[model samples]
Target: MTATTAPAPSRLQRVAALAGAETRLLLRNRTAVVNSLLLPLFLVAFVPVAGLGGDGPLGPRLVVTAFAVTLVFLTYHNLVTTYVARREELVLQRMRSGELTPGEVLLGTAVPTLLVTLAQVVLVLAGTAVIGEWSAPTDVVLPLVALLGGMLLMTLLAAASTSFTRTAESAQITTLPLVVLASITSGIVVPLTAFPEQVAQVVRLTPIEPVVELARLGLAGQTWDGRSVDWAAAPQPLLVLAAWIAVAAAVAPRVFRWAPRR
Candidate 1:
């Protein structure tokens, strides 16, 4: 009898194997553990003290704020550091020589971060439901869109950021500008309604703003001023998210470096 060659792994198996390895590496890094898991949870607890300080349902606003901040820390910030570290260590370049495609490599690296963010979001939402007495969302699709779109956008942005990020340590400094800006302008620290109308309009166009707005809209059935809006309004923020994702996706591949920056 002739021996047969082993079949290549399917795409799902390849991605899963990569993700499993990435998850183990993430757990081994204590700093990443604190930043990804502990810091976001701490921020959620701090939100009530900071206060939403405006009209509309407090529960949804609090929940959305938690969700947005979690995404920033777990998805965007973590991925930037991971990408930079992997590049500097030549892991990315070596992986490219294997059977995994570039997209598969990125998706695998991102899966752990995305899963962590999702878990934290669920915990925050559940806690808010019990403690804040929040109700079910009026429209689930918008918030779902917000979350899924935010993940894709943040992932692409993280990859794009690796273009300029010289070292893993520098990622902390480089990520701060966007993180601070998003916290302020994305209605996490303060509601968009707190800003003057002209300023809010311009701020709404910022990358993370649409995600926050959609979460607020879907969960509270209210806009910035706490006015009720219908399904027709969903398309606006959704389109904005798509636009940002498009821009980032286009730019990331063009600028991304497979090797560490010299």
Candidate 2:
């Protein structure tokens, strides 16, 4: 008997195939696209152009907060609804028939989201540069750590959030805790400077604050607004973000659901 063998797809090909399908689905899901991309961009574009903060090009801190919020919208908020919807529809369960592992499925799902987040970051940087004389990052490593950490933490949290979320519609309510906290307390919509000193001190410990602060610190020591901040204060926030990431990672896998609760 003649041997017949077909070429097997590589690992990257498999993930790419999954991502292609996911991208198509995301495109059709206009609601998800609007929530993740269009709205976040609107806020970022609105801040400085709307003159919300006066004639200045907006402070580095404010810029940082805006970008951090975009990341959360794209990575965390988007994934929560997507995962829940897929699980409820049994799409995730159906994928089990493939030659892929659970980890591969999740990783594949994230590729498009990650690419979109990277583009958002580039837009944030370019937008800041156009608005002001943005400086090169003071500490390259820390900013990278902050972005990567924030993404990882949010990923785990998204998966974990699905455990509590029962339907695609309810995701709006379940995700409100994080979205509200970031917008109100974590300096996304409002800056720390707006808060009273004592309140700001406590708010610094909030989940998204460190990532936002780290983003600010990544900019030059002296910003276009002639604002000078202490780079030496980086350690504390770094520790806070790292601690949260650890907690989320450890808890996510244990709590994440692969199927609908009912």
Tell me, by lDDT, which candidate is best.
Answer: 1
Give lDDT per model, in order: 0.83, 0.72
Query: 1-262, model 2: which lDDT tens digit per residue?
Result: 9999988887788889999989887779787666555654565667665544212335554456555766676788878888898889988888866787776677778777877776666666666677674666676776777788788778878888989999989998999898888777665456666778788878888878788767666654532123555567678888989888888888887887888887
Candidate 1 regions with alpha-carbon error over 4 angstroms: 34-44
Instruction: Estimate the Cα RMSD of every predicted model relative to the unseen true structure.
Output: 1.8, 3.6
Please give each candidate's TM-score: 0.93, 0.82
Q: CA shift at 133, candidate 1, in angstroms?
A: 2.2
Off by over 4 Å in 2: 1-11, 30-37, 49-62, 130-134, 193-199, 220-231
- lDDT score, candidate 1: 0.83
Query: Cα deviation in Å at residue 101, candidate 2?
Result: 2.2
